[model samples]
Target: MDTVAANGTGGDVTAKIAGVQALLRGLTILDVLADSPDGLASLADIAARTGLSPSTAHRLLSTLVERGYAGREPGSKGYVIGHRVVHFSTSVRRRTSDLRRLVRSHLEAITAETGETSNLVVLDGKNVVYIDQVEGTHALRMVPGIGSIFPAYTSASAKAILAYQVDDAQLDAVFTAEPRIKLAAHTLADRRDFVAALTAVVKHGYAVEESELAEGVSCIAAPIRGRNGVALGAISVPGPTQRVLEPAPERLGVLLKKHALHVSQALGFRQLSCAAG
Candidate 1:
């Protein structure tokens, strides 16, 4: 308040405004460098992208590099995000609670839209952990006590993420990690069928669990990917099987994918764009 009071005059205000402008310019340079290919940017490229003069861009880039938000490439003259920035990024991502907080609002929105139970599930070790959920409007709903753990193969939420398994080795590891007791009609008949089913989930863009975990309960889920295109987690909407089947489960699948993408984007997930040949 004292600073503002002293700076209330026109000249002082102008000086303060100029200082703010300089700070914004420095941050803009960092943004450009962070998004560039290989996370490196040249001064000319930064100036072109930010529309700042060569001198102004260089001064701000220097400030950022000195402050550890950015750095110079070892061999080349290009700029990249500094160690401090990478440290903060990894620290935030390592906290499961931070991710839950970021996704809670989206879970609420999903429940509001679909009027069914909405959940955010993360793959913890071999089991899927329910970190967050929103109660739906329906009187009868799947209200599992929060923090419940379910096998990855039995629930749609985990299946959606496991569907993107890159190789048989990883799939086999997950299977070995989690014991699978054959549940006659619900469980996949064999490893071959399970692998084939997961491939179908990836191709279908979503996963469906029809009375797999609990009788009369069904769910549709989609994998949420991070900016690096890694599967971070999955979101799901589960309700009674009869209602899920009627009026087309595919419609719910579409809506689930839309919300899942929103959550993924909130987590700094970006879809890869294919360039025209």
Candidate 2:
């Protein structure tokens, strides 16, 4: 031991080992909590699941909570994954292939259910670019191939995303770039009309357009939200006006909103009003 100290690495090695052990134990606790059926676990549940003594679990949990990696369930003795964890997850998913794969399933589901083209779009300044698509089964279906770009204010998908994601300053910037680009008779004419349309999207939780972007095309879309309730992008179903608009647009809007919420949740988004657990 004296020789080990003389080498000046005895305490350093011991501390590193201790730190590694603590990290493993902490990660174990997180895994236990994550695998909980409803994302809620009590102290005893965590201890038993992690194979740690209750005292040890409690001490670790206290530290985790302080660091915002864990949170207490309001009105109960349960624990939940904290917003910080979700934020980290969202950030990673946004930039990786994981988000596209995760969203692909929902897009396929929407196309199957609606018999219309489903698209995944992300905002790029004043434009919304199509990143992925699940073509409709119908031979005459509308398919905006991947990488298609459109003015944000004219497309249902773009409006749905911008409504939840943009602020007044952002809107001003958008208008400054493209004041108006009328594509059809029903296209919104100016900034005031576009802003009003966006406001309606916020109230309805979706957006719809009838031949606003292309002749005889219609679309309904919902924002894919993040943990902070801001839009990450949008999911949309686009098809012929005859099929999409013959039945009120609200009907399709409801379906789009439902699947969009599922995708958002899969991305670890949770409404602030919801209980932590």
Give the clashing residue pairs of candidate 1, or none. 227-269
**lDDT, candidate 2, 194-254, per-residue tens:** 8788878888889888888778888888888877677888898888888887768877888
Relative to the true structure, how large is the alpha-carbon lDDT of every model?
0.72, 0.78
> Which lDDT value does model 2 have at 179?
31
Whole-model alpha-carbon lDDT for candidate 1: 0.72
Question: Positional deviation of 75 in candidate 1, in angstroms?
Answer: 71
Which pairs of residues collide in candidate 2? none
lDDT per residue for candidate 1 within 1-277, as digits (tens), equals 5765666776788888999999888866765664452467899989987889989899988888888988999999899878776665445345777767877887888788778888888775455666678888898988663555565666777778776544455456556642354543586535676666676677767788887766777888888877655567888887898766558778778887887778777877666541110
TM-score of each: 0.60, 0.62
Best by lDDT: 2
What is the TM-score (0 to 1) of candidate 1?
Answer: 0.60
Worst 10 residues of 1 by lDDT: 268-277
Clashes per candidate (backbone, < 3 Å): 1, 0
